[model samples]
Target: MGVLLDSFGPALWLVLSPTNLVIMVLGIIAGTILGALPGFGAAQALALMFPFTFGMTPEAGVLFFIAIYAAAEYGGSIPAILIRTPGTSAAAITVLDGYPMARAGKASRALKISLYTGVVGSIASSFIFLFAASGLAWIGLQFGPSEMFAVGIFGLSVIGSFFGDSPVKGFVATGIGLFLAMIGSSGFSGLRFTFGQASLLDGMPLIVVIIGFLAMPEVFRLMAARRGDDPEVASLGGENREANHVGLKVMRKLVPTMVRSTLIGTAVGAIPGPGATVSSLLAYSEEKRFSKHPEKFGTGIDEGVAAPETANNAVVAGSLIPSLALGVPGSGAIAILLGLLISKGIVPGPLLFQQNGPLVMAVFAGLIVSAVLMLVVGIAGVRVFALVARVPRYMLAPFVLMLLVIGTYAYHNYAAHIVIAILIGAFAYWLETIRVPVIPIVLAFVMAPIIEANLNRAMVIHGGDLSFALTRPITLIILGLAVLSIVLGFFRARRARHESAAAKENLGETP
Candidate 1:
């Protein structure tokens, strides 16, 4: 306890410094702008800012990134509510109810609810991070390669369930992502895949691939949909509508939903894969199930806004559990953070905690401060962010595309990477039209190499005996869970179809 307290003191002091405080504030503000803008996301924002952080101390650099992450999760909801366009993929669930509320002239109320829920959820999860992270690290230390591979498989399977209506499409996307991951030089053989071009010798850069597949495509899609008409701006009410109107009563009413979503978010975050999108979707569904009047959910109720907002924001801290403890990132933003950590000569496994305990504690402390900063900035600037809804899509699209191009090129200073990004963007656009979920593809790309390499290593160590996978208790348990998840997903889909049919019959009879 004494050692822990001693370690925490430096972190606490570091976060309290005026310079670090300014960084946090600026990061949050920048993240909010990026998140509120169409075609910009946390991953892109972080990737764009990576070069700028190269000169800072590792502690300050990481804190800056965390601030952006925490703020962006909340900031995405602004556009989600005001424009029916999710600024980040995690905000997709928010649009279900948030946009509806805005159309009903309750945009300010909905935004306030989301901001408050985010602040509370973040604070709650920070406690989880402080207390539970060490225990999770202990458990992670016990995991062998077989168990790790199984965990990766479980993550890919969960992605299938989380994506849209078609599990087949999701799986296909996952398979493609895995195949893309195989393009790189193999660790064991040092051989490249399908490489005729010399430029492919180094394989695709993860940052480049992510930026191309996720960010650039969205930019193109937005540009394609550009129009000349000015967007209608929603006004935050005048003097009577003081920001403080988001009071204790509202917090009291939202407490149950907030707590439930936070728990769900934390649990999902602790999982090896699947990130904020899954957490938000699950929380939204659970809220719908427990609501007294389910019909009011999508029509724009406070509960609807609270559920997804709280859940997604909570994911900011939750994702770090796997990344910090296990050397695995559960989301794209964390994946970028993992790269940044690597660049800073910090390995993410157990050694990270051992070698840089104070830095880790400082990161946790920064997260807490960032969350508080998000609330302060969000409340004070709700009206300003709402104004972003009025930006012309034409102007925004070009600037976003330009950033994507520059960021991708700067990652390696290779014109080939820029061309690859454009090509991937076109391919992604085509894939989207076919109703494939890009999330599984991204997860598959991230996890495939990890799974394959670990599986091979485990096999080699076990004298090539396949039974080694089941011989390990952790691996066996994870396999069982994966099987159970598939079974449950099948039943859920069937039940949903039955309910749909029954609702149709009832409507026909009543008419």
Candidate 2:
């Protein structure tokens, strides 16, 4: 404890400095503005902001990015409450009750509940990041090649568990991602998959692929649809201040729901692929089960707003755990953030602690500071954000396309990347039509090369004996766990079907 305390002392001091504080404020405001805009989110913001971090030290770069991460999550709930449109995909569940509250003349009240829960969840997740990081990194060091490969497979299994009755399509998407990972020159072999195109030698630039996936799909959707009128800043039927105030009595009632949602969000975030969308939905479902008035969940209830808002924001910190401690990104945006860490000469995982101990603590301090900034900055600018959230998709889509083109081309100063990003964007947009799980595809692509390199190295060491790879104690443990996880998932899926059928039968009997 003394050693930990001494190490954290310098990092704490860094967070208190004026420069870092100023950057935190800037990130919060920028993230709120960008995130509150329809069809713009963390991925687009991170990609667009990636160039700005090129010259900073790794510690400061990470601090700035995390502030964007924490604040953007809270910002998403703004449009979700007032306009029946989710600013981010994870906020989709918030629209269920949030819009209803607005229509019923309590939009401001719903916004306050969302803001308060988001902060509480972020604070809780930051504490978890601070205390749990070292232990998680230590455990990550225990993984051998086989163990890591098993871990990747476990992450992929989320595709089946989450796709809601369709595992085949998810696996198909995973296969494509693996194929993308196999592009470029084969590492120790003199062969390449570039098809004689010179620009393909480097595989796809990470930024290009990210832009294609995030920016392109959003733009296409906006272009094809008729743009709706943006909502009014005053979300209520009338500007009644009394109905929009969340007093102590209501806050006291919401405390238990927020606590439960925080725990759920942190757990889901630590896992690699399920992300905030799943966490919010799961928390919403569980909150209903735990509620005294379960039927009121989608009926403009404050608890409904609080449950999902807290879980999704908590996921911001939760998703960082695997990326920082295990060197495996928890989501696509974090994968992009991981690329930034590598570019800055800071490799994540166990070695990170040994090589850059102070930087690790600085990261923790940054998260704590971001949580404080979110509370102050979010409330102060709520009105401005509400106004900005009304920006039309038609005007915004063209601006996003410009960002995608410039960000891709400037990253490597290659026009080829711009073309590649557009092509991939078109492909990714098509994948959305089929309900493919794109994030898992990107994650598998990133992990495939790592898994391949390690597996081959292990095989050569064991004289071409594949069975010897399974003999490592850590590898065996992860394999066992993987099997157990699949079994549990199968049963859980079956139970859900049974419950759904039983509900239908009960309804029939009542009629």
Q: Tell me the TM-score of each prediction against the true structure.
A: 0.71, 0.63
lDDT of 1 by residue, 263-330 (tens): 88887777655578768867886787687875476677889899989998888888888788779886
Whole-structure CA lDDT of model 2: 0.71
List the pairs of residues colliding in candidate 2: none
Model 1 residue 360 CA deviation in Å: 6.3
State in Å the error of residue 13, model 2: 6.2
Model 2 per-residue lDDT tens digits across residues 1-511: 2344566889889877898888888888888766765545677677778888888777778888888877778777886776554557677668768878876767677888888889888888767767775554454445555665665555455434433244456567767777887778775465467888888988875556545664577668656645454343224443677887877888898899989998888877776655776678667767876887655766799988999899988887787877776788867778888999999878988577666767777776777789888889877765654443344556656765675576567677899888887788789888878777565455456456656676666677777677854678766666676566456556656776797899999999995
Instruction: Report residue 61 deviation for candidate 2 (angstroms).
Output: 8.6
Candidate No. with top lDDT: 1
Candidate 2 shows a clash count of: 0
